[model samples]
Every structure is written in structure tokens, then in C-alpha cells.
Target: MFAMLVRLYLTVAGLLLCSMLLVQQAFPYLFPDQYSQSARHEFSGELALLREHLRGVGIGELPERIAALNRSNPDRYSVLSPAMALRLPARVLAELAASGTASDHVSTEHHHVYVRLDHGDVVQISYDESDFPIRYIAYATVFAMVLVGLMIWLQPHWRDLERLRDAAARFGDGDLNARARLPGGSSIRQLCVYFNNMADQIGCLIQSQRDMVNAASHELRTPITRLEFGLANLGDTLDDRVARARVHALRCDVEELDLLVGELLTLGMLERSGPMPALERIDLSAFLRASTGVSAEELRIRSTHIEWELAPALKEVVVEPRSLGRAFSNLMRNALRYADGTIRVGAEAVEHGWQLVVEDDGVGIPPEDRLRVFEPFYRLDRSRDRATGGFGLGLSIVRQVIDRHGGEIHIESSPLGGARFVMRIPWHQPGEWRGRSRAPREEPAADAGHFEHSFHLQ
Candidate 1:
């Protein structure tokens, strides 16, 4: 960490130092007015002054004055450039020859400038070094400190981001409990909250799935064991009454096993994937007739007052028939199980779609238990009440189907004081595929994975 930060700081600081040097060198040229109010030929100013000083001091030889100045600074020199010295303004040069010392800036600020000696040779002398190495050192120090401040601000954010990434990686690798642990006031606290929420939800779902699998296994073992024991001991109970009873019990066990397998496959299908969707324009009137017709015998047996309140405007809809049919069947069966003598099935148009309400005039679901009844294998009574209880996957399948159709199914208290299953499904106007027969979907592909409707024993 130290090495990496150091390297990064050095790289940034180096670049900034270089930029500072470039800007400083370019500033005087880019904006000349800002650097000076008027153009001053500094070299010429000192040169004119040198001649005046030399003549007034009665200096005959320039070497003597140069040697004397050299003793004080060791950087003074006089070169005989008589050819270049002649082009000066003679008046200014003559006037300056009467002076002693030049301006302080001309004497000290400039590193090198030429001066005309009374003998006409130009003297070249340096006052100060213009490299400004100290200024560059100061720039580098400030730049490094800025980089340090930036790193200090970024370090915590990097640590938080890295920790979040690691936690997500571990979660993806099946460590469901993995979570990003951040301290209070951390900058990424919101992101970590979302991640942890997602993790918790996924963990709960997986755990629920595991619980369902274990429950299914245990439930399945009972019927199989009963069948095995019944069959194995059948010969010993050779009496006619005993043999017949054993055979009946074995048959019941087989049916129970079949029912359990079917329900499991149904639930598995809903969980694993989406339904194969090929939409067609469905005549709601006819579709409802057919679906309810299949349950006519049970409805009649119970003498249930069946009422249909389908709106005339809700005549046709685009839908995947097989999936929709299953949803209707599950709701109808569920309503019939606990409904009183009257069952009301209604359909009406809503804002963006249609609403289907399947309610029965029976004991409504308890307020607190309505939501959980939709969960797989959850029983409201939690007793040995086989007549009213179901495999608990019915509403789950209903919800899954409605979800697949881009709709919502809500349980409500009906006008008739019973549990109402309300489904609001959208219906877009059919395209060219309206009323066209879709290519037949191959079965068994889904049959093995998919589960069936909720099963009620009574």
C-alpha cells in the first residue's frame, strides 16, 4: 500500500511540477501586458548607465573596473564587442555616461546583460543565477502535499468499494451469508445497505427452497413407506377382508404419492423458469365457460350458487391459454374448498387491463394469515384438518402464473364476506398472431420440472 501510494503521489507531483515550470516560462509571453506595463529594454538601460559611470569615474581601462567588480561577485566580465556597441542611441548613451550607479533592478534582478565601456567594448556581467531552483523545489513540495491530501480523501472510499466487491464475489460463489460490513458514516453506506438487503432476500429464498425440498422429501417418504409395508405384509393377511383392506390402503398410498409428485413438479416448474408464451386472442366469455364447465360437477354437487359478472366489454383478450387456464383452475378449486353455497366469479375492465375476481361466500381467510397462505406448504389451520387444507402450492402457482403474464393477483375480502382472489391482467390489442394457432409446445420438457395446481384433499 505504501509503495503504491508513494508511486502514485510521485507521478502526479512530477507532472504538476513540470506543468508549473511550463506555465511560468510561457506566462510572460502569452500575456505580455500582465508581466509589464511598458516594454523596457533592460540590457540597454544598464549599458547606457555603464558608459556614464565609467566616464565620470575617469576609468581609462575597462579591465581594472571589471577586475574590481569580479572581486566582489566573481561573476563579472568585460568583452570587447565594439561592432555591436556602435548601434546604440548616441544621445542616451552620452547622457548615461555621466551617471554613477544604475537602477537597483538593473544591477541585481538580471542574471546577464551587456554594458558599453567608455573604450567602446561591451562588458558582459551576471548579477544573479536565473535558474530559480529554489522556486521549483517549493513547487514540488506543495504539489506533493496536494497529492497526499487527495490520497487521504480517496483511501476510505477505495477500501469501502473493495470490501463491497469482495463480499459480492463471495456471495456469488455461494457464500449466501457474505455481507459488506461498513462502519457508521461510511460514504458507501447506502450501497452496502442495498447489497445487504439483496443478500438477505436471496438467502431467505434459498433457505425457503431448501425447507420445501426437505418437507417434500419427508411427505413423499410416508406414502411410499405405507405402500411398501402394506404390500410386504399382504400375503400374511390372506383373509379376504384383510387382503382387500390392504389393497385399498396400498392404492390410496400410490395415489397420495402421485399427487405429491405432481404438486412438486408444478411448484418446481413455476420456480425454475417462465412459461412458454405464445399469445392468441382468447374469447373471455368462451374461455370462462370452458374452465368453469370442467368444474361443473363439483359446483353442482355442493349446490353452490355460481354467479358470473363478466362485463360485455371484456369479451376478448390476448393471452397464453395453457398458463392462464392453470391459474383459473387453481383459483376455482381453492375457492370451492372453503366456500359456502355461493361462489361469485366476476370480470371487469380496469384502467390498463381487466380484473377477475374469484370469491366464495365461505369463511374468509384470517386477516393475519392471508399473505402466508400463498407460500408453499404453509397451512393456516396447522392441524389434521384434511378437508379444508391443501398442499399450500395453489396460490403460489397462481401468483407465479399471474406474474408470468405481467399481472398482479391480490387477495381481498369479498362483498360476500369470503376470501377473494383478484387478478388484474393487461390486454394489449392483438397483432397479426391474433387467433392464430401457435406451434405446439413440446411437453415432458416442462412436465418433469413443473408443478401442478394446489391440491385439496376434500
Candidate 2:
């Protein structure tokens, strides 16, 4: 704000300087004669001295300078006294001289002039005094015009600065939409344009974080209530095996709740700010295989067959290790949850970059629900809920992490009649593929016909 004010002041000062230059150019024409009244009095005295000096030198035939000099009546120059007469050429002296001019003794008080010729004649001259009033009005008009012009030039700049200050104040008060209007297509427009873009990004992040928290809280409420009710019922049970079973179920519910809260907190913190992205070259194929192994093992323990493949063209990428790990983990978990037969993880090189596909031979999501699944805590099967157990933040967290890394994640139907999750993280360069292949995605027969949206319940 201080800086903006300084700029505004400088702009106004420049305008004022320009106005001053213009006024100086028009000053003489607007105010006609510039001579002072005192200068005119001095001119009269010099004329009298010149007349005396000319007469002493025996050239007294010269006419006075100030002959009753009305241009309208030039045929008769008004006469003044000999003492007040100013010298001029002998030709002008003959024109102004007249006979019997004693009655025309021009008034010295009015600075009139009279002259006599060698023929003993005299003539008088005087000036009209009315031009001074017109000159005074013209001077006042010109001064007022310059002052008004200066104000007119500066008004727009002042208004623009005030508007900018008001917008900044509103933004400080949390009105993120407040924007300074930049006048004229100049550097100021560039500044305002950039500031507005920054504000828009900030608003989106803030609103997204708020929505995430609200949805997470709402998703957690049901499992928490169920946990509380189950515990209350457990206190009244007497059977050992039944109580143990109920307690185990309660423990699972508690763990699910804890997981949901932890994931939400992670998403929130990621929204606020996270570690700066460090770009390091890494073998992406190895990274995906290693990360998916943990989930693959867990699924295998349940006798679930999974397939992992790494393409020869799949190369390394420049990315943050932890964020990439998180995104890969989410994709693996989502596949593990619904895979009935096989889960295939592989990468392929494309012109844009590398495309990583996490495909499973399970029922793909309905077309309408695919987009909604990317939202936090938005589960498609309401019956399974959190008790059957995933908090539904898996895809959302995946998207967030990928977005931060400037990559894109896409969802579509797989060739194996299952969901296909495609992630494209641009490879750093050509010929960087480096990782061993795991087994191909396989589908088991037991879960074939039983595949439905409520696979967790089954």
C-alpha cells in the first residue's frame, strides 16, 4: 500500500508538471500585454529626458513620443505642454505641430504630450485607458484554466489508487474475491491480473479443504456411533466366545475410525502446505512394484491372485518420493478391495509421457459414480459403510497427491471387465525404464459370479 501510494503521488506530480508546461506556452497570448504599470511610468520619464537633451543640441523640431495618440483620430495629434514633450524625428514633429496650441496644453497629470513646430504651431495627443480592464479579465481566465487542467489530469490516477487501497483492505478482511481494478492497459494491469489469479487459487484451495473436513467428519459419525453402541452392548454380554468376537469387531471399527481420521488429517495438512516438491530422478517401475508389493502380499494372504507387470518402455520420472508413494499406495488399495480374479499394474510410454495403469478383473464402477468416487468419503455401496471398512478417501487422496506433482489421473473401464485406474507421470527422458516385472494380473474363479458392489459384505 505504501508503495502504491508513492506511485500514485509520482503520477500526479508528472501530470501537474505537464500542465505547468502547457500553461507557460499559452501564458503570453492569454494575457496580451505583460508590461507593468511602473514600467510605463518609467518610459514616460525617459521620453521627457530625451526631449530636453534634443532641444539643448538644437534639434527641438522633433515631435513628442506620446502625441494625443488615439489611432482613430490620427489626423490631429492631441497636444501636451513643451516640458512634457518627447523628442522624435523632424518629419513626425512637423505632422504633430499645429498653430495657436496654447489652449491645447495637454494635461501633465494624464501624461499627455504637446509639440510646437518652427512655424509657431502646436498639436496634442492622448491614449485611451480602457484596454487594461480587458487584459485583467483575460489574465484571470488563463490562471483559472491552468489550475483546472491540472486537477482534471490528476483525478483519474487518484481514484484508481483509492480503489486499489479499498480492495486490499477488503481482501485483508477475508473477502478473497475483492480485486483492484486496473485502469489503462499498462503495467498496472499486469500487476492486478497476477494478483487476481493468486487470489483465485487461494480461494479454491481454502474451499476445497473446508469441504474435505466436513465430508470426513460426516463419514466418521456413523462408525463412531456404531462403535459406541457395540461397546455398550458388550458390557452386558456374559458368553466368553461371543464377547471376544464382539470385542474384535469393536476393535476393527475403532481401527477404521482411526484410519479415516488419520487420512483426513493428512489430506488437510496437504491442502494447507506440505514439503516442497523435490525433483529427483527415480526408477518409476521399481517404485511402483516395490510399493504395490506390500498390498499384493496382503491380498495374497487372503488367497487373492494379483498380477503386476512393468513395461519395457516404462521409464523413470522426476518426482517427490513420498508423494508418489502415497498415490501408488491408494491405487493399489482400491484395486485390492475389489479384485475378484486378477490385478494388473503396468506402465507404458506415450508421446506425452508414461502412462501407468492399475487394472483389476473386478466389477468396474458405474459411469455416473466414477466422478463422485473421486470426492472424499463418497462410497458407492452405502450398505458396506465404514464397518466393512475403507473410508472412501482413497481416490481423493490419490488425486490430490498427483495434482501437486503436476500429473494427471484418469479412471475408465478396463479390458478385463474391471476398473482401470490410469496415471500419467511424465518420464524424465528416453530409455530410462529400469525395474523387474512381477507376475501378470490373474482372476480367481470363486469370486466370479459373486462379484457385485457389496463384495466386502460377501
Candidate 3:
């Protein structure tokens, strides 16, 4: 707001100054007679007194008299020969001869006057301009007035713009109901109205989309259940082995569809505007252990090794266990799908918060695709198959959960030679617990197999 005001003030001041200068330059040319009259009127009294004094002095004594006047006055005085005076412009010389006094403005600041004495001598006077400070003060006063007026004019507009900007920001951040409310007399009231209307349309559109997804997911469950039941009964009745296998495959496809519907429902619910989940204080180490244990048991047949590196200083931290656990479980399952042999999970106390890291020693995601991986239904080119990638909603759900908890997540190249998922949860003040230890700790060993069990750094 201040910047806007400054810019406006400077622009107005510059244009005003330029216009004044332009008029000053053009006025003399556009109205020569009027300019001459004004200048002559301004110096008329001084010229009259000097002319009278010169008239009393003899022609030969005029130099000494004018020199005396020069010493006593700021205006320079001199005596000129009639022939020398004739060197002036014809019109000015004519005016001087006719009026006995004539003036010429040599510049905006300097003026010249000529007077004919009775002795046929010409007295030339030059003004030494010294009103610069006063002129500058006047210009400064004008600029100051302009600044004040600009502030008064811009204040309400700036306030209205700030309100509009904040409303747009909140709307972008998923506050679908956020709208700009401006006073009726606001200069940008029309803009605010348009913004509010846009917000309303967008809010309705998003609400409709969520409602449709939610309703559709619910509607799909009944048909999916019937398909599953029919497939199971058909598989039991089949006598041929190939037919049984085909029936089993059909059941698997129906289960996959059911899983997709369930994920859609979860994503839809997460997308809804509501209060955050209730937080609970839980032991960080135990939470990590339990979240990883379930995934480890499910993937035990793959012979994948799981390692935990929990900081000893990390004791109790507050979090919404259900949502956070879902996020962690999704990350673990994602790592399980891609990991070659080892998966590493770590939790450590960080300044003002805690950090959770999940890494797998598999093919790392491309740097270009890291951010897009968190978009719903967005999968890497290599993970397009059902066997390699689920419905591509896992990372999106994780991001939503982290956002709800006022945390953030990012992907990096893991030291374990694959993709790393890092989640940082800021300290929740409701059930805040600060670690007693603040000692410096070293980085965990890069090799996950080096730690057979959870390694706690004290």
C-alpha cells in the first residue's frame, strides 16, 4: 500500500513539474505582448526611480552614478551608448524609444530593462535573480499537498484491494466459502462484487463435484458387493479348473474396483471443508513401530527387511493418530511395492517439530515427477500397470492428511539409493511435549541392514 502511494505521488509530481516547465517555456512565445507587459509592470517602479536618478546626473557623470547604484542594489546598473542600445531587437528598441522604458526577459530568471535619459544616454539595468529558494519551497508545498491528497484517495482503495487479495488467497487454500465483502462506497466495489461472484460459482462447482463423487462411490458399493457375491458362488459351482481360475480372476477385478471406490470415497471426504481431526499425544517411537509393523507383516512374503531409526530424544508428540497413521501406512505400502530388499523408517526430534522419513532401496522417482506424484490419479509412466501402482491416490491422500495437520511433505533421493518421503509435523501446542535432551546427534548409517532393530540416538 505504501509503495502504491509513493508511486502515485511521484508520478503526479513529475507530471505536474513537467507541465509547469512546458508552460513556462511556451508562455513567452505564445503571448509575447502579455509577457512583456507583465515583466514591465513588475520592474516599473524600480526602473522609474533609477531613470529619475540618472536624469539628474550629467551624461559624463552617469557611469559614476550608475556604479554607485550597483554597489547599493542587487540589480546591476550600467550606462550604454545610444548606438550600443540600438543593437537590441528592432521592436524592443522601438518600444524603448516610444515608451521611454521597455523590458526584456532574457530567461525565466534574468530580466533586462532599457531607459532613455534626456541627455540621449541609455541606462541598461539587469536583474540578478535570487528567488530560487522561495520558488523551490512553493514547489515543495505543492508536492506535499499532492502527497496528502494521494494518501487520502488511495487509502480506501488499498484497503479494499487488500481485503480482496486475502479473500482470494483463502479461497485458493480450500476455504470455498471465502468471499470478499467490500463497503458500498469502495472504489473497487465492482471488482469485489465480481470476485465474490466468482468465489460463489467456484464454491458451488467444487461442492457439486464432491457431492457427485461421494454419491457415486456410495452407489457403486451395492453393485460391487453383488458382483463379488455372484463371483464367489459361481467359483464354488465351477467344476473345470480353468473356469474356477477365471472366476477367481473375475473376483479379483471386482475387488480392485471396490478398492478404487473406497479410495475415491476417502479422497472425497478428505476434500470436504471441516474442522481438523482430534489430536492425541502418543509416543513417537511406538507409533512408528506399530504403523510399520502392519505393513511389514503384510509384505513378509516378499522377504523385505524393515529398519527403524528413532531418535531417543523423540518421546511424546501430539498428532491426529488416525489420519497420520493412514498417511504413514500409505507411504509404507508405496515403499513396499517398489523396494528391492530393504525399507527404512525413521523419526527424529527437530526444532519446533518432528520429522518422519520413509525410504526404499528401489528405483528412485524422476525429479521432474516428484511433485506431480502427489496429484490425484497421477502416476509415473513406469508405474502405469496395476501390479506396480495402485489407483494413484495414496500420495494425494498423504498430502491432504499432512495439510490438515498443518504439516508438509516432500520427496527426495534417499541415501538408501531410492526415493525418500519426508513428513515434517510442526509442534502442536495443544498437547506439546518438548524433549529433555538437546545433545547433538550424528546421521544414521546409510545401510539399513546395519541396524537389525530400532536404533535410538541419545
Best by TM-score: 3
lDDT of 1 by residue, 81-123 (tens): 5565455445324433544112122322353344445544556
Model 3 stretches astray by more than 4 angstroms? 48-57, 61-76, 229-247, 293-296, 381-386, 431-458
Tens-digit lDDT string for candidate 3 (1-458): 98888789889989999999888777776877788788778878987787777666787787788778778774488788767887887767888778877777777677777778887777778875655688788888998998999999898888889999988877876778888889899989999898888888989999998999999999999999999999999999989999999999899889989989988988887787676656688988878778752554656777888888887888998888877888898898899888998899888766456778899999989877877899999877545556785888988999888777766677878888999987766777544323212222234245322221121110
Candidate 2, residue 329: CA error in Å?
A: 1.3
Expressed as tens digits, the lDDT of each residue in 1-458 for candidate 2 is 44654565566656766776566455433532232123234445644553454443322433443232334456445434454444543433443443211121122123234445344334443444444597558756765665566566556666766777777765653455678877674445676677778778877878776777857776787777777677767755746877777787777767677677778866765554333355677887778777763454677665666566676655666666776787788887777777786788876655445566788888888877767887878887676564235777777888776655545666778888888877655444324323211112233235122112221100
**Cα deviation of 271, candidate 1, in Å:** 1.7
User: Which runs in model 1 stand beyond 4 Å of their true positions?
Assistant: 1-246, 429-458
Q: CA shift at 417, candidate 3, in angstroms? A: 2.2
Best by lDDT: 3
Q: Report model 2's TM-score to 2 decimal places.
A: 0.46
TM-score of 1: 0.47
What's model 3's lDDT at 87? Answer: 88
Q: After superposition, how far is residue 370 of candidate 2 from its true place, in Å?
A: 2.0
